[model samples]
Target chain A: MDEKDGCGQDGQSTPGVNIMASMEGRGPSCLNVDKDALAGHEKPGFKLCSYVDSFSETHAGRIPIVKSGLGKEDLFSTVYVRWGIRRHDYKVVPGLYGIGHPDRASEVLVTANFKLTFDHLRRALPHISAWILVLDTKGINVWCAAGKGTFSTRELVKRIEACSLEKIVDHKRVIVPQLGATGVSAADVKKQSGFRVVYGPIRAKDIPAFLKNNRTADKPMRQVTFTLYERFVLTPVELKNALKPAFIAALVLFVVSGVGPGGFSFSGAWERGLLAVLALVTGIFSGGFVTPVLLPYIPFREFAAKGIIAGSVFAILLMVAISSAINGMAGFGALFLFSMAISSFLAMNFTGTTPFTSPSGVEKEMKRFIPVQVVALAVSSGLWIYSAF
Target chain B: MKNLRYLDNVSTLVLDDEKCVGCSLCTEVCPHAVFEMAQNRALIVDLNACMECGACVTNCPSGAISVSPGVG
Candidate 1:
């Protein structure tokens, strides 16, 4: 442990239990490689790296915890969509293991096997020692896993038998995330595992308080708080994921204008580079960052639609400025094509995160909008070619 | 909207009434208000509006619900 490392507000590595190993295979130490800016303050020793800047988060509250048999750095982390429709596939593993030396009487808290879910749960309860029974939800978060049948009664019962949870903990009560209430039947879990399922807070921060107050979730604890901080922390990964496709498409458009013969020319290709980058970066911020911040208030309802609307507005503004300074319809063509690409890409990606979008809905959007986007690109390219000629 | 006629009317959710224990977890998690409880059982009041997050089908106690997508 680094002496200067910031251990959150409570000076503990996690809220309720000692973080043994994360699902991303992190050991005792964490290094935030692609950590987002939203992570409040970094404790020097905290290691972080993600397929998408997975770390760089800080807790505003506290909970109790103890390290499992797994060390700190070797623990697992990172979220991956392995199968289809963005199903989670990473986790801290399930089963009974030695966390804080096999405390015989420790409370049992169950969570999804998702690495991020495991990390937040461990981080929030850093002060308490307990048994964290990870349910195999294919690396999904507790709430999501619960709704996915991965944390259902049958699985819970099987896991209990497999891990012999009754043999380890003296308590007959198992704390489960309220969000997981979707997938779990408290009574059914009780009938199968002999442990009373107590629903915990929606956010991990309130875990310590809930446990201290006789393990009960208050009305507020049951409420899902999608606060600004929560949404902000997710931006880095989405933005980074979007960067590659944006640049490649922009370069192609610019090169076509510069190197094409007759209807296409390279004379203005260099000038369009900075302009393309500006449109792309602006579109990204509008859809990836700004729209999410204003999600609830954005017009036209659906998350993807809202993002597109935002991107369109920004694109219009960009075109207005370009048209005034450069005086050409090529700028408008580029503006339309770029905005369509950026917005559509961002909107399609919403399938990974939003709670309301269905697989069917996403599929429908792709079928309808993809053709429009392709035609838009074709038209824009044609326009550029004609102007060059 | 072009090739798909049921895009606005089809739901991927299926309820195995035999497995359902009448828990309202599905109703609470669905933001679009696709389900409602009736006679200690969940009824899809607005099947066309379901987002298909699998919250209900996955969370059912008796394993009552099954979901598949169709343009319908």
Candidate 2:
């Protein structure tokens, strides 16, 4: 054990738990793999978070013990991840973990290895002592990982055996997050691993209540809600994803607008390009931000239709405010069409982000709306260029 | 999620009540609140709200629920 490692804040560290398994002065030891082999396989300079302050010696092996409190680094990483920075690399070492001096009889809670999900789970278990069995979902959140098939019954069963959970826990029951139910068949898991799967609440925050209520979640805990705050937080990633393409599209429009009867008027390009860029940015916010925030209040079920309405309203307001700057009716028409088409397309793409949209529903809408979006884009491009002359 | 409703009649979720064992796993696993217990048997109360995530189908011990699971 590393002498520098300190136990939890409470000083109630399990007697048999080791501080850390020394590995050539490396700060933290990876319980799943040896340091040499893990270094060769992992991306260069990439290291799992140093949340394991100590280790619990289990019948399976030495398992990392994570504290319930999150440090500054953990909070900062969560913010960075929310903004879509280094998203794919944000994961923890998937294996068994001890929250608060969990023993053989402590409840075993299964979850994905995405660092954010792991953080949330550990953060909620401050007073509760439990053995967390994290499944490797490749940095994806529980719901998305479940839908994508990474957090499947096979993985759960394999992980159970690999961690020697049968020896670690006295009870033959494991609690999986309800969202993971999409991929994990409880019946199959029970049949394969001799462990009964009891699905926990949809959100980590509700876990304490769930456990208190005899491991049964009420209707509120089971349901997934997309609130205004939830929708607001999700918009940054949407904006970041669309920003690059929107920038390129704006640049092309600005350059093409320079072509006139006077042979590339710099003044004309500057004026018209500003208008085109504003329209594009407005479209992005209207569809990517506004539509999502007002998703429930929006009139239509089809995101494209809702986007068109929102974009048109914003475009009309902007044009009316700057009518004197526009050349003619064609200029106004071009800007309106550009904003509408961009917003509609972006909104349609948001189907992938929503929890309630089905693949069949998205496919149905795409088939009906994609051709319309293409036509609008083509006509708007033609009108935008023609009005320049 | 309660106020927000998607396109009507689009989900492919189907429940075979005859095969249901009244285990209530379907109701517990459904995140959209699509399933409801009626006379101790699970029923699809809100088919339109179903996103076809297949949580109910996977958790149903009796194999009464079936849905073509797919991500949007």
Best by lDDT: 2
Q: For model 2, what is the C-alpha lDDT against the true structure?
A: 0.83
Which runs in model 1 stand beyond 4 Å of their true positions? A5-106, A126-129, A136-140, A143-159, A171-173, A178-201, A208-225, A260-267, B1-50, B62-66, B70-72
lDDT of 2 at A291: 88
Tens digit of per-residue lDDT, candidate 1, span A247-275: 78778867864744554446667665556
Quote the TM-score that chain A achieves in each candidate.
0.68, 0.86
Write one digit per residue (lDDT tens) for candidate 1, span B1-72.
Answer: 111112364456777667778877666544455678899888888776665655465456577777775441
Q: What is the interface root-mean-square deviation of candidate 2?
A: 1.9
Candidate 2 lDDT tens digits, A25-105: 434533332344344335678664457645677778777778565644676798998889998899988889888779988
Candidate 2 residue pairs that clash: none
DockQ winner among the candidates? Answer: 2
Error of 1 at A21 (Å): 20
Of the candidates shown, which would achieve the greatest TM-score relative to the real structure? Answer: 2
| Model 1 deviation from native, Cα RMSD in Å | 10.0
